[model samples]
Target: MTGIKDVARAVDMSTATVSRALRGLPGVSDETRVRVMETARRLGYVPSPGAAALASGKTRTVAVVVPFVTRWFFAAVVEGAEEVLRDRGYDLLLYNLGGDEAARHRVFETSLLTKRVDAVLVLSLKPSPDELIRLDHLGRPVTVVGADVPGWATVRIDDEQAARHATDHLLDLGHRRIAYVGGAVEGVLDFTAPAARLAGYRAAIEAVGIAPDAALEADGSFTVAGGVRAGHRLLSAPERPTAIFAGSDEMAFGVLRAARELGLRVPEDLSVIGIDDHEMSVIFDLTTIAQPVREQGRIAAQQVLAALTAQYWVPEQVVLPTRLVVRRTTAPPSDG
Candidate 1:
């Protein structure tokens, strides 16, 4: 089998220099790095992951923590992170909590203690104080997605601003009785997006000199079925809202279904808007605030890599932009 020594001999470089170049370590000149790579390729020499780990004390693996792997947003983020990790010659370790408290506990308490990963990338989870302390004990680089954490790298959208944008669009269409469907559960430990979005919804209405009504706020649980339930409850009221702002496109899809079941015409009798331009949004004709879901994952992975490579790296707090995507579901209220 071809080896590093053979490549180093072919390139007339020291084994240490070749090793440094191959591992992408600093202090190697660009010209020598390129030559070592070309010679290694010519000799078909492949570095063993175990040997690399032994040399650098790095596992060459990153762990990605998600609430549920089946969800669209989580799945898309994992796909994007995997792409970057694969290209950078790293392996991914996935921790799927599945919304189970025991599973979440086992992951943060025991599983992460195994030292199997060099870094961690968390998705949408606001860990408890104990959990955060446990993660801090790991002494490894950690990057969070969809939530902000102190002293850690984060990649997320401005949830409050995005929600405000969605509500403002409805208000501009003369929707005074706008109903908000969100995913928050009271007295439950969860992520921060739902609360931030709910605040934004209230802020938009209050800005226009309107008092926010608790009756119009429905918990959609960030799912299509939940949206359907919320939709029915809101539509059945004596004074139904002409417009609804769902926290996610999945919920918006449910609202559309509910509207259809109730024999109402979209944009004629009712209009709806949502956040996250989900893959199925086009089919649903959902007007939404489009966020770069997959891009957030890619950026989080890049952050992990940057921390791994840099000797003195500062944790980054990256907030991406969201834009309103006008589609067939939103329009001026029929009365207007």
Candidate 2:
């Protein structure tokens, strides 16, 4: 059986140096670390798990906590984070809170405390002050994606800015009677995103010399079905909006269906835009504000890895950018 001793001898280094290099500890130069790893691979050397654990005090695993695995954004983020963790010789432990308050409480109170993970990456789930306190007590490195938390590393796009940009696109297209289809202010998960987007939409409308009309707003619940319902409500109104900005691409799809059912031609009859250029965006030709959801996950994972490797790590807030993507769904309103 290949051992650390054989690898040490082949690399002409002390066993301590070889061990440090293999486990990615600080005492070795990058060049030496690379050489030791290469030799270990060639010799097919495997370190004893017990010995490795004793030396590094690490489990070589990361926990990823998310609200819903079925959502495209959450799934994409997980895929990106998993890719990074896998490449770094780490295992991922997924904890789905299932949008249940009980499940969420249990995860923060018990499941996480018992897990042997080196770090944690939280996706789109905002922790309450009490939950944050529990997390701090765990003493594990944590990185968050999709929302900003004090004293934790985070990766997120500027939600308000992204929404404002989406709204601005419609405003620029001569759209004044604009409507918003988004999550309800109180009931939705990821509470910060929906609120911020709504604020942005309002800000843009106000900046264009128009007061935001409550009648023009509808709650889409951030889903296709919700969008369908909201779309119907908005379109059936006595005074329908000329343009609608949906909080998500899925909701925008619902709006499109509603329009088709009403015999309203997209752009010609009702210009629509959405956030999150989902995979089906191309097929639907929906104009949207695109955020790098997968990339945010990858970067958050990277920050977790960095924290694990560093002797002292400071929490960072990384804000990525979003851009408007023009497609066939948006245009000047027919009345213009």
Candidate 3:
């Protein structure tokens, strides 16, 4: 079988340089990385992973746990995470909770532990107090995305801040009567994002010396359909709010649809702000606070690898940043 030495000979580089390049170590430069890969491909060289693991005490694998792979946000996170992982010579093992609570328990109880991975990366899988403690027993490195996990490290956006920014944008646009649309329990412990964001919205309103009306806060599912339902509930009331802060971009799109159905024009009849900056947000011209979802995923994987490799330790909490992207969907509310 072709080996690193043969590839090194073909590339006219030292075997040690070839080895480091192939292993994705930092000492290798971009040119050397390319040269090693080209040489390996041309020579049909495949490294023995099992032997490598035995020598290095690393499987070169990481496990990712998430629920509801169908959502655009989660999928984006995975895509961003996968690119970084593959580039680092690390393979990914994916587990989807598939929206089943029983399946969730089984995964935490079984699948995550038995893996030959050097680290574990989780996206919004709400491990219970017990489950979190149990997961720590795996004795592998740990990192999380989108929510808090005390013992392990995390990479996430400031959910409350993101929500507050969205709310504050409406306030800046002179929207005193802004309403909020958010999600209820979806059986995912990782689903605390919405609730925290709701708190942010209320805090913003209270800071302005305005009483937060419970009637103006509506909850439903986290999909477009759910947004439509919650939109109706908020807008149909006798004292309808002139602006809306949706927890997700999907929910914001639903509010847009609801406005049209009710003969209301966006920013003309009602201004809307949302979080996540969903793909449709740009096309729909919706204003939003964009969370670095994909970046968070990539960083989460990197943090896990750092933990496993003992390179450096970051803070227990790694908070990703967010910024507001304004578009045509939001404007100062009409006095009429």
Number of the predicted model whose lDDT against the real structure is largest = 1
lDDT of 1 at 81: 97
lDDT per residue for candidate 1 within 1-336, as digits (tens), equals: 999889888988889999999987889999998999988988899998889888988878999988989888999999999999999978999989888888887888775545688999999987778878888888888898999887779999999999999999999988899999998744334878889999999999999998999889999888899999999989889999999999999989899999899988898999999999999999888999999999999999999998888889999999999999999998898854
Per-candidate total of colliding backbone pairs: 0, 0, 2
Per-model TM values vs. the true structure: 0.89, 0.87, 0.85
Cα lDDT tens digits for candidate 2, 1-336? 998999999989999999989987777999999999999999999877667866777878899988888888889999999999999988898988777777777788775544478888888767888878888888888898988897789999999999999999999999999999988676424567888899999999999899989999999988899999999999999889999999999999999999999988998999999999899999999999999988998999899898877888899999999989999999998854
Kindly list the per-residue Cα lDDT of model 3 for residues 1-336, writing each as its tens digit.
898889988988898788778877678999989989988998999988887777667789888887778888888998888998998779888878777777777778775456477787878755677777767788787787888776568888888989988999999889999999987745454587877888999999998999988899888567899899988888888888899999999999998888888888888989998998888889999999988888888888777767766767654788878999999999998879
**Reference-based lDDT, residue 292, model 1:** 99
Candidate 1, clashing residue pairs?
Answer: none
Off by over 4 Å in 3: 1-40, 47-57, 185-190, 311-316
lDDT of 2: 0.89
Q: Write the candidate numbers in order of decreasing lDDT.
A: 1, 2, 3
Q: Compared to the true structure, candidate 2 yields what TM-score? A: 0.87
